[model samples]
Target chain A: DTAVSQTPKYLVTQMGNDKSIKCEQNLGHDTMYWYKQDSKKFLKIMFSYNNKELIINETVPNRFSPKSPDKAHLNLHINSLELGDSAVYFCASSRGVRSYEQYFGPGTRLTVT
Target chain B: AQSVTQPDIHITVSEGASLELRCNYSYGATPYLFWYVQSPGQGLQLLLKYFSGDTLVQGIKGFEAEFKRSQSSFNLRKPSVHWSDAAEYFCAVGPGSDMRFGAGTRLTVKP
Candidate 1:
């Protein structure tokens, strides 16, 4: 069984279109995070939710928004998608805010054309 | 702000050869350290983590790392590396809400 899983392992969309990537975790963790891996392979944190409450948020574009229905799910939505939006997005979860280990999902490869 | 640095962008080693990947960090206080591995098209997997005690921490896949507060380094080492070990390795520092990762070192195994 997958601890953390993201749907649409590959997403391809045209510029200016809107898209969303869904993420879920079965680890029964309280904290979840969203990360973007650029072409250079640099992993940057975009947002984090602890017990469905927004916690860590980096300097991401306004077009991107994260919604967590509960502790098990955190979805990412992008409005007015641009070419720069192409990258691999990862979802992760930990037992708590300062847990030692965080589990990661396979990641969704989002490509904007 | 906290930051991590992996000096070598890439490293190559032969099967059964010893391997060491250097990682340095800049944090204000004592830090929680971790080493993660990511294969092609895969997510990050925690190889090991250091919270407290035990300077030398052992991890899966025959990997181990030493935590040195003096040099602010947490270098991953393996006496013998296998071909399957070829992948990207990342060093992260954080016990708090914010965990920062280094640029990562890509390992290539030679035949």
Candidate 2:
């Protein structure tokens, strides 16, 4: 069983299209996060959810939104996708807010044409 | 602001040779340190973490890290490197909110 899993490991879409990446964590973690890794492999946190509540929101564009249905799921929805949004999106989860050990999924390689 | 620096962007070592990856962090307090390895086309795997107590912590896959408080460094070490050890290594340090990761060091294996 995967601890943290993201659907559609690879996404290919045209610009201006709207797409969503789903994520689920089997581990009973209270904190989940979304991270974006650019082509250069520079990973940065986009958003974080603690117990289904928005906690950390990095300086990201408004086009990207994160929704956590429950403590085990944190999905990312992108509106009006841009070429710059073509990157590997990763979903991660930790035991709690204070926990530093984060388990990441395989990652979703999104390609915007 | 907290930050992590991995000076060497890349490193090459022959099989069975010793390996060490340097990591330096800038933080106001005693930061939580971690070392992760990412294989090609895969997610990051936690090698080890140093929260408190022991300065030298052992991890899975025969990896270890030494936490030096004065130098603000947590360098990863392996006595004998394997060919499969060639991967991207990252160093991170943080707590409370988020962990800041280094640029990552790509390790290559030489025959």
Candidate 3:
């Protein structure tokens, strides 16, 4: 079984187009996260949700909003996407907010023209 | 603020040779350290982690790492390299919800 899964393995859209990526985890984890990997392969944490509640919000712009309908699902919606938004976004989950290990899903590569 | 650094951006090795990847971290308190590997077109996979206790921790796929608090370092090593092991390796530090990852080191194996 795929512990963590993400939708739209690849996305290509215009700079002004909006898009959303969905993520789900069957690990029964209470904490979920969204991470952005840039062209340089530098991974940065964008947001974290624990049991559907926002726990950590990094310096990401307001255009990127994460919503967790339930503890098992967390989705990311980008508004007014810019060219700089092109990167691989990965979804991860941990047993808890303080868990040391995180299981990651196959990343979604986003390319904005 | 906490941060992780992987000094080597890329490392190449022979299939049967030994391997070592260095990682350094800066945190105010005792840190939770981890080593993750990402194959081409794949997500990150946890190779090993260190929270406390033994400084030397063994992980899956013949991977191991040693945590040195004095040096603020956690480096991953293997006795021998496999062609399948060629990938990007990342070192991360976290004690809470926020985890910081290194820039990652790309491992290339030569047969």
Candidate 4:
């Protein structure tokens, strides 16, 4: 079984368009996270949710919003996507807010033209 | 604030050769360290982690890492590397809500 999974593995959209990526975990984890990997392969945390509560929001632009409908799911919605948004986005989950290990999903590659 | 540094951007090794990937971290309090591997076109997989027990931690696929508090380092090693071992390795530090990851080191295995 895939502990963590992401939908829409590849997203290609035009500039100014909007898109959303979905993530789900079956590990019964309470914490979920979104990360961005730039072309240079620098991975940075974008947002984190614990028990459906927002816990960490890095200095990401307001255009990007993360929503957690339930503890098992977290989705990212990007508005006005720009060329700079072209990169890989990863979704991860952990047992709790202080859990040491995180399980990651096969990232979604976004291309903004 | 916590940060991780993986000085080696890329490394190449022949099959059956031994391997070591360096990782250094900076944090104020006692840190939780982890090593994750990402194969090409795949997601990140936790190789091992160091919470508070023994300094040496064993992971899947014949991988191990030693956490040295004096040096603030957690280096991953393998006695003999296989071609399937080639991948991007990341070091992370955290015990809270936020985990900091290194830029990552890409391993290229030669046949």
**Which candidate leads the pack in lDDT?**
3
Candidate 2 segments exceeding 4 Å error: none
Give, for candidate 4 chain B, the lowest lDDT window spanning 10 residues: B91-100
Candidate 1 lDDT by residue in tens digits, A35-81: 99999889898998999999999999989999999889999999999
lDDT of 1 at A51: 94
Q: Write the residue-wise lDDT of candidate 4 on A1-113 in tens digits.
A: 88999999999999999999999999999999999999888899999999999999999999999999999999999999999999999999998888459999999999999
Clash pairs (backbone) in predicted model 4? none
Give Cα-based local distance difference scores for all models.
0.93, 0.93, 0.96, 0.94
Best model number under DockQ: 3
Candidate 1 lDDT tens digits, B1-111 = 889999999999999999999999998878889999999989999999989899999999999999999999999999999999999999999863577889999999998
Task: Write candidate 2's Cα lDDT for A1-113 as tens digits.
Answer: 98999999999999999999999999998999999998877789899899999999999999999999999999999999999999999999998878369999999999999
What TM-score, computed on C-alpha atoms, does each candidate reach? 0.98, 0.98, 0.99, 0.98
lDDT of 4 at A19: 95
Candidate with the larger lDDT of 2 and 3: 3
Residue pairs of candidate 2 with colliding backbone atoms: none
lDDT of 2 by residue, B4-108 (tens): 999999999999999999999998888899999999999999999999998999999999999999999999999999999999999998773588889999999
Q: Could you give the CAPRI-style class of model 1?
A: medium
Provide the RMSD of all predictions against the true structure, rounded to 1 decimal.
0.8, 0.8, 0.7, 0.8
Can you tell me the DockQ of model 2? 0.68
